[model samples]
Target: MVNATQVSFFTLSAYFDTGVFKYLYFIIIVSLYIVIICANLLLIVVICMNRSLHEPMYLFLVSLFVNELYGSTGLFPFLLVQILSDIHTVSAPFCFLQIYCVFAYAAIQFHNLSILSYDRYLAICYPLQYNTRMTSNKVSVLIALIWLFPFLAIAVLISLSVPLQLCGNIINTIYCDNYSIVKLACSDTRVNNIYGLIYTCLIVFGPLSLILYTYMKILKVCFSGSKQTRQKAVRTCTPHLASLINFSFGCLFQILQSRFDMSSVPMMLRNILSLYFLTCQPIFNPLMYGLQMSKIRSLCKSIIFGKTLTDA
Candidate 1:
């Protein structure tokens, strides 16, 4: 174990003996990264170029897509390089940076979904106020908060983490997660552990409760309210619900992986489960929103078939 001041690198524990599959892994990961970029960027471009798609819902979607890009980028670039090379090592600074990006990305998803729940709540539960409540300025401010709050929350965790004297230089996982680094610290980590739990509760349950309540109200309205209201809710809420479910599964898988000893599981399965959240969400979210929402779908189709993307 190197002293905190002297330790400059960390070796990931999850880089298994792929042997001949290194090249194959490299090709697959590169292909996935490219698809993630293209899928998300296409949807983002469609949203930004068309003024008609500019609203609280679409704006929130743009933020979600941006999260996918930010989150995926934090992983894929480094992953691709590592796959091509023999080194399975990362510098302390880069490791910490990845931790920040990945943590912030995960935390912000909860907030984004929470804000979206509120947005949907207003739009469906209180239509007249929706216009006033979800104005351009409000949406912009909320978007800023969605990004800012998570950064600051995780920033505090990372700040506490920076001063820790690590007991080991190897991370058990493929990526630099907050808990993985904290686990390696030789210092008394009661404070970090407690704080991490509280933060997790706040990030997870707070948004989850809000999302459930909002959706519950939306559901009641769907059952009791007019036909038009039910149809509208179905159209708007479906993608958000789908995205939420997908993200929740990823979060659940991550929690289970971190909390339990999964070494007995097959190595390939373990890697796939651990990395699913980081990789799959990035690919799935863009498709969830792009294809499910008719307007964006039409815009994407037009851009593809009409070849009028240059104007966009």
Candidate 2:
């Protein structure tokens, strides 16, 4: 093997214990990835084809579904190959690409959720104006912005990272991430660190705060109104709430993993927790929403089994 002085490839140290059963693990991982891809694509197609679902709520959902595919594609294909291989090394450019994709995925997830919450707020609190307010053109612009903001923000973040001089190239995680890559830099990464914190606040916590305020307003209006209104609010918001909680847990895992000392945590458990955001949220969001939302659920049933079932 021809050798160079600086690190050109990063050997992922997280897969150290995957010995004889790597093939079995590989199969399982590939199966899950396929499932996430199929589910997201199906829902996206359904939303797009049905004119009834072309409204702001479903449009936002379709955007999210697309992002799920975007995020999963970044990790799963590469991950499947790594699971079956002996040497788990990633080239430099590929690592940075993964960094961009994963960060953008997570950032956009929060933005999408925040947008959905805002839609619900307007719908429930000011139903008569919802149609006027959330026009098709306006929704289109919002959707474009939702995708573009993260793409640009993370692009800047990745560009800043591009100039870093690395002291090492071994990442201690199964997947490549911005912070993980930054930790290997030879020079002081305080700028990157500060930027990351600010970026996290802008993307994750900022959106979360807005969502909370929206929910509080929704709750206020629901409680002040009739029983029917309360029920309607609950029906529409429950699935969103479920998704928010699930995604929050995944985000929490990522934040904790990056910040805290996970040495005492079992390796298998750590791997699972680290993977939760990427592995679980993609499948969970659409599944939970599709089943809970009557229109999408019935549409799915009608298309799948040739007849829609009557609501009991």
Q: Please, what is the TM-score per model?
A: 0.95, 0.94
Question: How many residue pairs clash in model 2?
Answer: 0
Instruction: Compose the digit string of candidate 1's lDDT tens values, residues 31-107.
Output: 99999999989999999998888888888988988998999999998988877667789999998899899889998
Q: What TM-score does model 1 achieve against the real structure?
A: 0.95
lDDT of 2 by residue, 1-312 (tens): 112235678888888656778888988988899899888887887788888887899999999999999999999999988888889999888888998999999989999999999999999999999999999999999899899999998998998887788777788889887777777777778889898888888888899998999999999999899898898899999988888899889889877887778989988898889999898999898889889999898888776887633432
Judge candidate 1 at residue 246 and give its lDDT: 85
Q: CA shift at 145, candidate 1, in angstroms?
A: 0.4
Q: Name the regions of candidate 1 deviating beyond 4 angstroms.
A: 309-312
Q: RMSD in angstroms, candidate 2?
A: 3.0
The parts of candidate 2 lying over 4 Å away from their true place are 1-5, 307-312
Clashing pairs in 1: none
